[model samples]
Target: MTIGIALLTLLHILIPIYWLGGDLGAFYSSTFMTDPKRTVGERMMALKILNNIDMAPRTTLILAFPTGFALAWAKGWLAVPGFAVVIAAVAFLGWLALAWAVHLNHGGGAGIKRLDIAIRYGVLIALALTGIAGVAGDVAIPFFIALKLCIMACCIGLGLIVRRQLVPLFGAIRTMTSTGPTAETDAIIAAVNGRARISVLTLWALVLIASFLGIATPV
Candidate 1:
């Protein structure tokens, strides 16, 4: 591989490693934050840590798309023109900036939030359809790449679901902070955590499988 391809491959490998690993850390911190036995102050600290750690996975997920495509093009696995690669990079960087902007906005940027949601679902649906079409031979890409697309789509889809679920979960946390924990709050917290865990672990499985496909090209 040329230096560029080598670097792309290294990035492709590292993004998922950090994504999954950082999510695992965030997951652990979330458990502590949700635990009823912990003092409210301690749980609040865990929440702070969890929010910070979560950015790793979120950023990685946004980045994986362009990086994956660039690697494929670099390796001659995909027949795309040079300008397309630049377009992909521009789109990725733009989305990355929007992601951080939304993060820093913290729900204040209603318009920015809507734009982010549109981009998220747009990519998700595009990948899902790409996978389906490729699997059905409606597209010309390799099967392993198609599978990777599908798996990546599934991961993002699950994460979106968990994001929606978090509205109530975060609300419950606020209530607990002001009114102290009640049985209702504890149950909501536990239930939300339980549901999120299942989706997140499913996402991990998809990420692992997709990473293997990218490396092994198992067809």
Candidate 2:
């Protein structure tokens, strides 16, 4: 393989590694952050660390599509033009910038967060449709690649669900910090965390399936 293709392949391979590994770290850190035995200050510190570590997976998710698209184009798997890939890459970069802007601001702006949510939903729908079309032979996408797209769509959907679930958790955390953790607030945190745990585990499973499909493409 040419150096460019090899590099693209390397990036495609590395993204999932960081995504899964970072997710594991974030999950464990969350346990510490949510532990009632921990001091409020200690929990907040762990939360900060969790947010920082979460950027890896967040960034990788944004990169995954464009990298995979470009790699597929290079490998003659995609029939799209080179310029189409360029356009897609530029668009992904814009999305990445928007995502980081929201993250770095700690989700301060409601308007920007809405925009981010809209973008994610749009991408999720697009991925699901494309995967279905490809698998149905309405598009030329390889079966494994098409399946990966569907997997990505599922991942994004779960991520959105987790994001929604965390809204109350964040509020509960603020309450705990200010009021020293009432039973109601602790219950809120526990309930939200429980819901989020299931979603996260499913997401991890989907990522593993996608990784396996990438490695062991079926006939």
Candidate 3:
């Protein structure tokens, strides 16, 4: 049990490192990808790199919940039953599989993307409600853990918002590829990038806040 707790704690710690670091890389790559001054092929290469780098953060986000849950259980911070842990493990595996599938088959995985988005919405709502309830003393969750849950929900929400905002950018990319870059497409790309920056920065702040919560475990 000691070994298990140590391992779980280590994983929980590493998650933020990958999540924030990977996102930083992806964010950097996107600047090059959306730069109209760059050749289309060059921009496309950057996009490829961004997508690959983004997988780390995406995977980490999915793992965060289960990893945190397991850690809490191991430390006796949460009274999670053995069967509940097993169920969570199963659900995490399924969600991870779906996320990877969508990433790998992005071009033709509209249905999968939709389903994944729906699942995210559900998780976001659950996390938010649970966090709020726990904080309000209506649930048995630890205050720090519940606070982290709310932060996680905010991160997930911002991710979804970024995705929605990127739709126009993606369409602009498609237009640039199919019809060559026009001022209109360039404007769209630049505009979307500018807008998405806010959410990205907010995500970084939220990640930092969550990291602090994990480290400090404030009362």
Candidate 1 per-residue lDDT over residues 1-219, each given as its tens digit? 689989999998999999998999999998898789998899889988988899999999989989999998988888899889899889989999998998887657899989988998999999999988988999988899999888888888888899887778888888989999888998998898888888888889889888888878965
* Each prediction's TM-score versus the true structure: 0.96, 0.97, 0.96
lDDT of each: 0.89, 0.91, 0.90
Candidate 2 accuracy as lDDT:
0.91
Which 10 consecutive residues of model 1 have the lowest summed lDDT? Answer: 101-110
lDDT of 3 by residue, 1-219 (tens): 688888899999999999989999999998998788999999889989998999998899999999988888887888879789778878987998999998888646789888898999999999999999999999988899999999999999999999889889888888988988899998998899889989989999999999999889876
Q: In model 3, where is the ten-residue run with the lowest total lDDT?
A: 105-114
Clashing pairs in 2: none
In model 3, the runs with Cα more than 4 Å from the true position are none
Candidates ranked by TM-score:
2, 1, 3
The alpha-carbon lDDT assigned to residue 97 of candidate 3 equals: 95
Which one wins by lDDT: 2 or 3? 2
> Could you tell me the lDDT of residue 78 within candidate 3?
89
Ranking by lDDT: 2, 3, 1
